[model samples]
Target: MSDEPLSIDSTSNEYLINADELSTVQYINSTSQDKVLVDIGFYTATKKDLECLLNSEMFLNDSVMNAYIRILKAQPSINEREDGYAYLETTYNANMICGDTITSLRNKEEGNFRLYRTSTYLNNDMVFFPINIKDCHWYLVVINGRKGVVQVLDSKGTATRRPQLHQLVIH
Candidate 1:
């Protein structure tokens, strides 16, 4: 958590050597917190690098969030799925169907679970489309169109490698 800022030598400055009439300020920090190292540099950043930075937790601050909201408002809506699925018109074709799982939540209400298996053709497309599954609600399947399989289970939950696709069948 040390905020010590390092200074760059004014004599060895590259921009000064080129006689560009520019002022450059540089800072360097070497520290580790929670097994994560934070290194930040200010300069000209490329679009791809900026995108990577946006996805990082460090960019979740108020200033970054406000900037992102402004940019999103200016951009067109990228969502193109008709069924309200995020990835309806992409190259991947996916379908959502009824599953064979019957599970009860902690509330003791019996509920039916539907499974939307990913097709080989749309495996890569899944990256762009994510299925939103709340605790108890209708699962929206996008990319293609059609339900796949079903699983039956008790209220108790189980964890799987891919929780979205696999239902932990509680006996």
Candidate 2:
């Protein structure tokens, strides 16, 4: 509801790098793609991935988005908030839900790989899915689990995938 920034790291930049992390960011920027800049949980950011954050024109990459989600999930304030919020990784929404049709997403075969089930999130008042659509755009799919409402917050107002996204969220 608020545009207020989350101080997950320290920097106000989308890259979310603090003064301490500037050196690491610089190293990653200077090095080749093979270099591992930051490893936050399952997501890894390399030189190529860091570019997405450093360069605002570039679309936000899955690794960067997921890494930030992981960081947000780890924040004490987010976890302690009255409105319990849960976060699903970019992989979950992009690959598992959005990538497949509602029919396939409903299939029980992929249940074992569901990250949401294994994640350490509190009760889902608001479930956030930071999605990378077709690797060209990034938007948020916020599910109000308590209120049974699904909201799409896309800056560009791309409604092409709304129907599919709704089906995926429900099923």
Candidate 3:
């Protein structure tokens, strides 16, 4: 948050320094509603570190999103960052079967939701469906074709998901 000389802790083993990605950012706070970032100092970080530091709003290019893709692809078990979820959805929309199918669906009455239907439904051994609801959100719906059970996974507990569950289907 400081605009002065930048500093980095040399003791942290989780972070590795890469001089190329180390750079400063500056901007003008034209709005009175929210406190804006006027400047940020430089600090050395690896590609992964830079990706972690960058937020959804700072996802200004493919490099940042690609970094996240590498992380998700490298390890699917990890809970994606909220910003990572944005990029995850983007890549998922482009490459995943659910992206090509009907992701936005309506109830029997008159409503719209994210409980999507995918081509992989009941066709593949494993399927992952992503859903985000208002107020609270679930990350993915894991359907185990072999087990014949559909499970919904979420890092954050849902308050409104119970109602949406009925409209959701694994196949």
- Per-residue alpha-carbon lDDT of candidate 3 for residues 128-165, written as tens digits (9 for 90 to 100): 54553422333566556656776777776463434334
**Number of the top candidate by TM-score?**
2
lDDT of 2 by residue, 37-151 (tens): 7798778877777676655457777777778778876887764457665555455555556665535645685565455543432355776666666557767777777678778
* Backbone clashes in model 3, listed as residue pairs: none
Question: Which scores greater on lDDT, model 1 or model 2?
Answer: 2
Write one digit per residue (lDDT tens) for candidate 1, span 17-85.
Answer: 223422212211232212222222222232222333323222323222234434443444533333333
- Candidate 2 wrong stretches, greater than 4 Å: 1-25, 101-108, 111-122, 158-164
Q: RMSD for all candidates, in order, please.
A: 15.1, 8.3, 11.5
Judge candidate 3 against the unseen true structure and give its global Cα lDDT, from 0 to 1. Answer: 0.39
Model 1 spans > 4 angstroms off: 1-75, 81-143, 146-161, 168-171
Computed on alpha carbons, the lDDT of every model, listed in order, comes to: 0.29, 0.62, 0.39
Q: Higher-TM-score candidate among 1 and 3?
A: 3
TM-score of 2: 0.68
On the 0 to 100 scale, the lDDT of residue 98 in model 2 is 60
